[model samples]
Target: MTIGVIGGSGIYEALPLENVSTKSVSTPYGEPSEDVTLGELGGKEVAFLPRHGEDHQHTPTGAGYRANIYALKSVGVDRVISTNAVGSLREELPPRTLVVPDQIYDRTKHRTPTFFGEGMVVHMSFAQPYCPEMVGHLAESAREATDADVSEDGTYVCIEGPQYSTKAESEFYREQGWDIVGMTTIPEAKLAREAELSYATVAGVTDYDVWKDDSEVSLEEVLENAEANQESINAVIEHAIRTMPEDFESEAWSALEGTINTPTDAIPSETRERVDLLAGSYLD
Candidate 1:
């Protein structure tokens, strides 16, 4: 029942992975964002990968998404809790807030969003994209773990970035009721589903974007809030892992069984070989 946690922005390094071990994984899709740190947390086995690499070298769009998800799957990680630093769109969820987003609206472009490509294709349901049960457990953890106001559920809008959105785009997101905005999470969530892993995001709100009338959202302010919020995020994670039930096998891993829709015969040999570690249950 090992769980994987992909630490996103301002989380370039995870608290020293206890009982540390290092694993270099090769995925059918290619290499992951970085080497994975395998260790013990809450007396349970766990794996952690820094999404932006150890030095935060990769941008959101530059993240090796397919490989990152595949590496987790390769290590027997059945569920993932991705953490990201996002800009708060709502006033109540201002800087230093924590949100466990239950839904996502994708606005990203130029990235592979699924594993079924080449000779195989599968259309999976994303109606309830993030895993509900997992999300509930996380929300509870955040509430009990920190003093930071934790929004139980929120809509996370994922946009292509290297550049923040224009004021018009930000306002449009507000109109659609988006709570936070970020550059990652879409294909990460999508690929997690394709891998049949229960996935959810614990987003750390670091700023009120430029849309805030009186406040100027600057990188300095974002960094300041992000630094302030890290301790709380760490608390939530530690507490969540400590209280995580021992039956992750039955609940979280079950999704991996029938979720793959690609027909066996139709799957290309190369793709199968490349993803053997991940899709072995269905392909083998």
Candidate 2:
């Protein structure tokens, strides 16, 4: 029962661990952003993957969400803890604040958000996007490791972006009372639900989005805040790994029992082997 850690933006370097080995995993979806680094952290086995390539080569839209999650699931990672750097939509969630968003408002226009494609069809309940148990564990670990402002829950507005939001767009999100804005959470959260893995995000507030009349958001500001908060983020991940339970039950795992719509005989031979580990039990 290994744990998975996905590093966002400024967190490209591998998590600090002892006895680490990098492994490459192939998934039906495609190649993951980077090789999975397997190692021991706080007496627990863990795997780490950088969402963007180590050099930040992948754009938000180009990040292989399906392959990444599939690779982790294939390697037996039952739960995932991801770290993201995002713009704040609310004034109080200023730079360097830590947020564990409970909900995601997906405004992303491009990207495949599921694994049951090809000839297969499936539906996953995403009403509660993030895993509740994982959220609590992440938040508690963050609080114990950092003195920075940490929030347990908020509405994360996920947008399609290789470009930052326009002022009007930022203002619109604020009007909707969303707590944070970012480019990566949509399919990442959505796909995790389908994979039946407990997933949680630890978002580091970088800047107030362009909506803030007092100050315009800038790359420099975002980078600076992200750099400052990176240590705290790492601490929370290490702590969470240290204390995580070995086994757990969730509606997420149970929900997969009936989600597969394609018949075993109807599926192509290649497709069945490709997706078997994820949804094979439900098929004939």
Candidate 3:
């Protein structure tokens, strides 16, 4: 099975993939953040996509979440591993800690979060946003492959941002018990479930958010820590891909089984064509 990777902040270049080639995939939603980089990593076929454009041109809210997920799914990717740079909401989970989040809280208000809204209605089970099995594998990989603190499960509060949180907002999230905060992950995770692709993220804490009295988030600080965390993140990703079971199965693969509400016959032809790659089997 081909593994897909969505590289977030500070991860602009393609992974160290052998026999690398690039494919420009056009999705029904739009263009992906960039062309998909295809190659082999640790004896596994891998497709790496930068969540932002190659030069980091796209903002969090501007990144084409739907197109990115659909493009990966189009390329025969069954599972996706995402990397993110986040701010710590808790003191103990300071900078450089790698968190494998099992839950997500969406604080995004503007982005399109689904591919089923226009002509079809599908209510995906999102109680557990990230794939549990994938989360386990990622946590295990981080533990074995890097010396960074590996947090098994945490709630990642994803806010809509090209901006960091204000002190008040940060404190509120802390009160709600969210562990780490980041800009991406909401529509990405949501769309992955809709696409029936197993998905999980290894989030690296880049800074202590403004919740801490003297601490404040800054681009320089975030970039520095993200750079520091890159080696560890890369190690964990490689290990996970190298050691993953060939026949690993996930509940996410059948996520759409009973989720579609719009009858197949009622779905518009254009909309059906748009979602064909994702729900054609069920609709047929």
Candidate 4:
């Protein structure tokens, strides 16, 4: 019954850890963001991984989405809290604010985003991409842990980029009414559901996305703001781990319940081996 914490930009170290030790795990997909750091936080067991490499080696598209999620699941982590740095599309949600976004709009183009493929076909529910249990627990923790105000709900717009959005692109997103924008959440959120894990993201607003004529987005600016807000971000996660709901379960996912399209016996042996940890029961 361990909880997983995936650290994003300007957040590579796992805070408030006790009895910390780094554990290396290799999944069928490959190695997770570096090694999984096993430790105790908030009276519960935890597995922490840097979403990008230790030196911030991977970009959003370059991060190991499948391997990262798979490594956590393999270590018996059924629930996850992912942290990200985002640009605010609306002025209502200002920079340095913490947000638990309830909705997601994917505009990303280059990522696999799933663990199931090959001879077997499995479909997952995307209606509520983030887990309700996670959202509730995360919000409760943020209220007590951070001095800053935490937005309970908002819509996240995911883009494919190492580059920040252009002014025209940023303006268009505002017209679409998206609350926040970032690069990594699409497939990371999508793959968590496919693996039958409860997942949520805590987005820290670092800029206004170049839409505001007075302000423009830049990596140097994003990193500076993110560093300023790291203490609050770290506190929310440490407290959230102590408050996670005990009854949280992924068994209610109907799309994952019986949605395998291929006949169990007909799945190719190689394909079965690759996805055995993911949808093996359906293929068996």
Which candidate's TM-score is highest?
3
Q: Write the per-residue lDDT of candidate 4 for residues 76-109, one digit (tens) a residue.
A: 8888899999999988888899999989999999
Q: C-alpha displacement of 190 in model 1, angstroms?
A: 0.7
User: In model 4, what is the error at residue 194, expressed in angstroms?
Assistant: 0.6
Off by over 4 Å in 4: 9-14, 250-255
Per-model TM values vs. the true structure: 0.93, 0.95, 0.97, 0.95
lDDT for each residue of candidate 3 in 1-284, tens digit (9 for 90 to 100):
99999995344242567898999999889899989988898789998899988888999999999999999999999999999999999888999999998999999999999998787899879998999999999999999999999898989999998889999999999999999999999899999999999999999999998988888789999999998999899888888998988878899999999999998899999999999999999988
**What lDDT does each candidate get?**
0.82, 0.86, 0.91, 0.84
- Compare candidates 1 and 3 on lDDT and give the better one: 3
Off by over 4 Å in 2: 8-14
> Residue 205 deviation, candidate 2, in Å?
0.3
Q: What TM-score should be assigned to candidate 2? A: 0.95
Supply the global lDDT for candidate 4: 0.84
Better-scoring candidate (TM-score), 3 or 4: 3
TM-score of structure candidate 3: 0.97
Clashing pairs in 3: none
Between which residue pairs do clashes occur in model 4?
none
- The digit string of per-residue lDDT tens for model 1 on 1-284 reads 78888885344254545788889997667888888888887687888888888778988998899999989988888888888889889989878889999899999988889877777656667877788888898999999989999997889999998788788888999999988999889799988987878888888888877688887677888778888889889888777777887755324344456666678887889877766665677677
